[model samples]
Target: MRWMKQYGRGDNFCGYYRLLHETFRIESNIERFREEFENLYPCNNSGKIGDITESYFVWEEEGDDTSELIYSVYQNNRILYKTVDPLRLLPFLEWHLNNTTLAKLDNYLQVHAGVIAKNGKGIILPASTEGGKTTLIIGLMMRGFKYLSDEVALIDPRTHNIFSFPKNLCLKEGAFNLFDPLRIGIQSKEYYVRSSKGRVCFINPERITPNAIGCPCEVAFLIFPHYNPSNPLELKKISKSEAVLNMAKRLLNLPYFQGEWLDILVELAKKAECYNISVNNLPDTVELISHLVEER
Candidate 1:
């Protein structure tokens, strides 16, 4: 329970404390932790600190072997995660920060989707993890679409404008080979082994394109993407009603909007072109989306 180092920014912060004995292994990985989250929240070394609101504490267990380092993450005195691999902690921490931020955003309609923009029009790709949202986002970015987020789409309920959440893109091992031709340098980055996603890497979206971060823009299209390697690429135009239903399923903060959730989603669906795309190959899928965006 004795914390050796603390990292803080504004109200949300996390600190790493040592249990039993101090380890140099934990100290060495601090730089990597900062780099992983630098874009979202530039953590400042606050030396040592006491309890604070909305903070996460990472407890490192004492071990003779550095390779066998173990850690547990706690929030509000409750254990959130326990891991033998230090790299796995980054994703869990990132997820906590995102959810913590999203919880305070009562005004915005948050949807579990990937958002990117082109020509001042925002495109929302609504899908869950391992559903190819991040892969499609990276492919779209390579084709000149700007990156807003690879995870959540924060939409202004009144205006239907999607704001930039621009956290680093998390790529699972399965999508690593897909971007090799682009030479985005995925091979050099450190990979984390997650229980569900296997190997994962975080890459800044800017690596794909200069000034890749996009601005808030009106919803122009809602593309629901499904990845199936065995199937041929298929694109089908869907009705606004269908789009609303699909989006509603992925909406993260529905209760935050109270009774206005349905109305907000309906307006968003009405304003944007909706399509369901079944994707097999990355090149063909990107090409099809490029044409779709250009024709709009």
Candidate 2:
């Protein structure tokens, strides 16, 4: 994809790319996205015209209705996705870019899981949207666990270790009020917005825990978390074989079954203790996990 003018560039574990565009109005939104994501893709330079850094177009002419603005994403001249709603633009870009990053990482395995580590021991919360994964991630962060990832969990298949894939936490409007520190003691309207997921806010992890970014750590436990406000917190041991099959189903960009990668994943599951936890109290859940991490 070619554009007359380039505004910004991004590069990280994913890939290096320039965001090129001509419109100032859409450029401003791109700037906001760049501000949020550039830290993860900390390239401070823009690519030259036609330079072939993975490129994308966020073009909406000035005075155009925001709802009608259509955007296209291209990598190496191949159009990946396009949509009419501007609300999906940022997240669409993020989700694809993250997957793109994982695809290029031959040595790493990516899972649809939230991970948090402490003192070189890591816990994997294997969950999907139904599991309240983000809420549990925030609750653990409040209790002082280093933030690894709220979405994708990167694993070194060879070492059975997990690393962080940090991104802004997208909090549902309802959960925003439950966590006081996340709210910063003020109204959430300033940072809130609507998306395909409904009302949400993007939170910088640094605000809650400085240097909370997680490092590679041994995969000590595989935890499946569920949140139910009316129930008591409960943790029950699960079969490693069951954990392997279940967590394997959560692989986002891993190789197919019967492959070497599949064997590696099974090995990872076998090495770690697995459990299912129902969390009614965030504090109790945190305390329980903290003890697990602290124990021999």
Candidate 3:
């Protein structure tokens, strides 16, 4: 039960902590989505991944060493599926590991992020690869904000409970030179680094997983992280409608997908502060986030 008990029910050692869902089961690593979903997706005849007009998913208790372990979701123009991984359905499983293991606690609605907590409040940094979400999260962690997701973040829309998706903080080539002085321990790489949403990836086990479910926290802010070279690090307040749209783009399908999440998001926007998190420099970004955290 090493995989089932220890790593499966584990913690992220990085910075912040998260609770893994129990329903999300781990299966054997899938080799190809096509081969595994021959009978599932029904569009197997279409050769291209883009040809999947209607998408579906499948799971297997079969894996091989050569198989690439992925956590992805897929869907069509309608009904978003956390279908990227054939054997996995949980969109926010990254909240439970410093290392990639399956099986999670069922109480959480996971989102994609690197969230750190302070005084029962958290911020969700919603962005994909090539974005500065991870960079900013890492900086916040260094300043003692509590690392949540350098990748994906999960939330219980019903309760507005923010969940953690703990992965290694990834940075690009020049990123190390930026934060190395801040005492951030990033194992240097001559080339690129492997990551969940971007380039460099780092996982801290204790920061993610735990035996019991973590309590929901208030979302003090939703800052869409963007790095502009000349733009100053300033927090621009946004309207609730705009915040909902941005959240729609960033939220994974967990508690619910489709417009079903509208009420939840609308409420979230009204309850939580929204901001256009612009950072021209990392230090300034850290300073701004620090200010926000201090408000708690």
Candidate 4:
């Protein structure tokens, strides 16, 4: 079996998927992969090319037709990750597409963060993978804060305004209890027990409300969130220089844009207040953030 298809032609993000197999159940796998990313992959069929294209190709080796599958993935013809489990293929594709598209973007400064806004000002939470960004942002959104992004914080370098990426928040199975007190329930169909990132589920921001999504806004705060149940909630001010340096390390798409990102990064860091927050309780953290937002 052999198949190829492209998604997001005119948008900033795009993906191309190709599959080759000797005699595996290709139709079933293709159907499942497309269904998984249907909502996340927006269609833009203007016949125009994007800044980046996330290319993924999976192929089985010669003379290998056993139930024990060994598939390999390639990005732009270079092998990136290989695995024996086929269930992880779709999510593996998504991870590459999300990062590459953002990395290749020239128009926006992609900060590795979660963004929530109120009163036309945005809060930037710069964190890495599993940095408590999604949990904290979800708490803020439930408290009436608008969502800009759960993935990367897209910022206009010149205007200092933040745009929305607004991808679904991917949460692990263990984190489901965090939303129980808020009366949010996870549907069984949304659960993926064998994802590339392990057992996880995607929760949309609009689950809070249709108006939960936010638009571009001036940045008000740059925060780093650290979740620790053993520690009390605390917030400490950090220097703008320190904030800029720290954020630089977390940038996903800036390296592909060359040296132009330096000035943009410096300007954005100077515009927003910087802080480090250690969170023990979600409700208390939200209250502290609300008080700070109100004070500004």
lDDT of all predictions: 0.75, 0.66, 0.51, 0.69
Error of 2 at 108 (Å): 2.3
Q: Which stretches of candidate 2 lie over 4 Å from their true place?
A: 1-43, 46-53, 62-86, 184-186, 190-196, 254-257
lDDT (Cα) of model 4: 0.69
TM-score of each: 0.80, 0.75, 0.58, 0.72
How well is each residue in 1-296 modelled by candidate 3, as lDDT tens digits?
A: 21110112122111111223211222223444232222111121223434222222223332355354334332223333333232233212232332332123233444455566666777877766666776677667666666555666666756776766544444555565665543333343222223333333232323323321223577878777887888766788889899888777765554545555777778778887888877789887888878877875
**Candidate 2 per-residue lDDT over residues 1-296, each given as its tens digit:** 42112323333222244221110111223444455455334343444455542455553333356544455555456766665544455666655655555555546777889998877778899987757777788888888888888887888866868877776676765676668755531263323334556656666677778887778888888999878888878889999888888788888766432376677777887878899998887668878988877884
Best by lDDT: 1
Give the per-residue lDDT digits (tens) of candidate 4, residues 43-99.
Answer: 333322352244355544333576564656665678876766454565665566555
lDDT of 2: 0.66
TM-score of 4: 0.72
In angstroms, the error of model 4 at 215 is: 1.0
Write candidate 1's Cα lDDT for 45-74 as tens digits.
Answer: 542434222556665665566755567777
Show model 4 residue runs off by greater than 4 Å: 1-35, 39-63, 68-86, 181-189, 193-196, 254-260
Instruction: Please count the clashing residue pairs in each candidate, in the order shown.
Output: 0, 0, 45, 1
Deviation (Å) of 181 in candidate 2: 1.5
Q: Candidate 3: where are CA atoms >4 Å away?
A: 1-111, 181-215, 254-256
For model 3, where is the 10-residue window of minimal lDDT?
Answer: 1-10
